[model samples]
Target: MNRQPEPRQAIALKYDGKQAPTLTAKGDDELAEAILKLAREYEVPIYENAELVKVLARMELGDSIPQELYRTLAQIIAFAWQLKGKFPEGFDPDAGPVERDITPPK
Candidate 1:
């Protein structure tokens, strides 16, 4: 019997209010390409943080994304969506229920 090797999963780049991260091209080929492409498509400005990209390259699929990392990615997605990018269309910034007075305005 022959054993198949595990497939490499693409890393999901995250961003923060301090910096925007993205790839150059599409697909899961290379980390840089994917980030640049997504940035361009979404009109999000990428930051000059090489270390971030390096960390992303080291991330493996099925791994739990770090809390800070997740927060950063969420910020980027929100920015893109707000800018009317095709990446996150129709995504509400506040998709959860909000506590507010439902009384009619008098």
Candidate 2:
């Protein structure tokens, strides 16, 4: 049987050291293309997880991601930070706080 792939879906998230990652943008098809283009132009790190994207695409812009996604998203965020040689302040591998602890905005 022949099968067709799903249309592209993309989401942009912003994470602050103090707060949960927020949904900055989301799109499908052309919009998804545009979002990816901008990310490329800005040299932003892109981490693709089809399953995560599906869940995130459901969120509205400015919404903090749900709690359950923390661990997986944290790993992705850590990867981005590593790529940039950036890390949270006061973080010590031996004694620092856990890397991620963003509560959804009230």
Candidate 3:
């Protein structure tokens, strides 16, 4: 039997240089489309990770991400920084962003 795909989901996070990332917005379906449209309009970088979105979408608006997600979220931010060619001094360009681990080892 065929199964329908899950509705699209989007989560937006903002991180200032000194603070942890905070969830700015999130939604599924039509709202997801609107979030993406606004991001596009503002030239925000988009990264696709359904599993990450699933977890992030659970957070309340304006909540900072928990410590456990720091490494993964850092990778995402590093990717955006790379795209803009604005890495901090001594940052290694040859070492690409960390791989996202959907499941952590026990």
Candidate 4:
């Protein structure tokens, strides 16, 4: 018999000026839809990466990301900040452009 694929998964993380990004929400199927809906309602930017979501889904809510994922997550966060046209705290506009070439985990 053919089985349906697993429902879509989503993970949300929040990074304030000080602390590392923490997993705030995670869900599958309808709960995933609700998470996306709330994010849209609040005008939150959504980044889609199924592999990244799969890795992050292993963590319990409120857990800071592992150091191994720091660089990858930083790139994602930086991209989000750029989309919002805002820099992270202590970012120096006068410091000239920063170059980054990030490869997502396999």
RMSD after CA superposition, every candidate: 13.3, 3.5, 4.8, 4.2
Q: Model 3: residues >4 Å from true position, as ranges?
A: 89-106
- Backbone clash pairs for candidate 2 read none
Q: Looking at candidate 3, what is the lDDT of residue 47?
A: 95
lDDT per residue (tens digit) for residues 1-106 in model 2: 8788798999999987778899999999999999999999999999888888999999889999888888778879988997988777866656755655554444
Candidate 4 lDDT over 3-104, as tens digits, reads: 999779999999985667899999999999999999999989999999999999999999999878888888888888888889967888689887865443
Clashes of 1: 11
Which one is best on TM-score? 4
Lowest summed lDDT across 10 adjacent residues in model 2 is found at 97-106
Candidate 2 has what TM-score? 0.81
Off by over 4 Å in 1: 1-48, 62-64, 85-106
Winner on lDDT between 1 and 2 is: 2
Candidate 1 structure quality by residue, lDDT tens digits, 1-106: 8887433323344433344344322223365466566667876565444455455656554344444565555555555555664343444546764354423234
Off by over 4 Å in 4: 89-96, 99-106
Which segments of candidate 2 are over 4 A away from where they belong?
Answer: 1-4, 92-106
Q: Over the stretch 1-106, how does candidate 3's per-residue lDDT look in tens digits?
A: 9999999999999988567899999999999999999999998999999998999999999999988998788778877987888786876779976455544344
Q: What is the C-alpha lDDT of each candidate?
A: 0.49, 0.86, 0.87, 0.88
**Which residue window of length 10 is worst by lDDT in model 4?**
97-106
Top lDDT model: 4
TM-scores of the models, in the given order?
Answer: 0.36, 0.81, 0.80, 0.83
